[model samples]
Target: MIPITTVKYPVNEFFQTIQGEGLYTGTPALFLRLQGCPVGCPWCDTKHTWEKSDNARVSAEAMLAKTAPSEAWAEMSAVEILNVIEAQGFTAKHIVITGGEPAMYDLMPLGQELEQHGYQLQIETSGTFPLHVTENTWVTVSPKLDMPGGYLVRPDCMQRADEVKYPVAMEKHIDALDLLLKNCPPRQDTIIALQPISQRPRATELAMQVCIERNWRLSVQMHKYLNIE
Candidate 1:
């Protein structure tokens, strides 16, 4: 159990509309994009998030002001954060805790507070950190190979992931995915989604075949193809 006494000063970005992909697609939710990711996926869309120095260290109030005022957000204490969410007119039960790898911080307090309020927590991670999350929280692990900081694949990440979302560009990515999959438990409930590298037809086709051969699922980046951010 994470100590609630620990203060959570999330160097967070803004809240947005519905998530673009994953199990929470189409559902309206708040996006907490915490800055600082070292995992370098060649095709990472939010490359801005890659460098922590690139983002301004703004107060949560300043961040919230950019959105609807009635929509609540505050540079808050964990307890204060819950109050802000209640203040927000947001009725959506889903809350996406994403990042520059949100796992970099201990999320037990945040997850516990949100879950207490009946909000379903979902974390989008790179399968690097030993995730501090609730049992019910959905973990989407998009593994990157040979990234900066010399972070190799860790088994704890693959094993904990409820879904394995891979970004496919060339055959090499499949090799990387297979390497990671070798460590995971052979559970039928584990969802494997193959998203093509930048909507490339050839990459998509390759991914489709891989999926069909292994009975894996293809996760098209519907938002990217539609040109929605």
Candidate 2:
């Protein structure tokens, strides 16, 4: 096996922030945003992360100092990452691995390093890439349907998801989710959460109504509303 210190991934941004959505909402967490994604959801908030450029790679300090989202990233091994986290003095014990599709890179090394030091790890994924994190990692699979990228949500992802946080903008979105559920069923105990697209009033209303009717959870992005991170 390759040493965990030798297995590196592109690190876009690493900071301390409150969990903005899904099941871990409001929880203080360390956010690790990886760089690079091919799943082109037109509504992607972090479009800057969609492409990885060799020229854009910078030092860890440069990546962490970014006040705005950009394509700039650092190539970091699991060991180097832990050192930065500790040096930053972040109080959060929960770490959220997010991105331009975090599952695009194997996370076992990262997961092992974090969990060994008593940190809880979570991943917010689009359900397009096969997961390679530790079994103990909390997996939130946000199913992206019929996006421009044309990537299909894997059935194995649905099965592995601890929560299915689907984004909905209209009744048709809910209809699509229903079809997906029928075709690629999640575990019986998986939490089903609906997040409104861009928090539009109509979208929020539709999400709320559907959540009420289906007994699913509604995930309002509190961080966005509270002006945090």
The sequence of per-residue lDDT tens digits that candidate 2 reaches over residues 30-148 is 99999999999988889999999999999999998988989999999988988998899889999999999999999999899889988999999999989999999999999998888
Task: Kindly list the per-residue Cα lDDT of model 1 for residues 1-229, writing each as its tens digit.
Answer: 5566466645455454767776666778777777667777665666656555523555666766664222222344557666666677667778888867788877888888778878888898888778888889898988777776567656787777888888887899898788778765425587898888877889999999999999888888666666754
Poorest lDDT segment (10 consecutive residues) of candidate 2: 77-86
TM-score of 2: 0.98
Can you tell me which runs of candidate 1 are displaced by over 4 Å? Answer: 1-6, 51-55, 66-75, 184-188
Q: Give the clash count for each candidate.
A: 0, 0
What's the true lDDT of residue 182 in model 2?
99
User: What's the CA error at residue 28 for candidate 2, in Å?
Assistant: 0.4
lDDT of 1: 0.73
Residue 15: error of model 1 in Å? 1.9
Q: What is the TM-score of each candidate against the true structure?
A: 0.85, 0.98
Alpha-carbon lDDT, every model: 0.73, 0.93
Model 2, runs deviating above 4 Å = none
Clashing pairs in 2: none
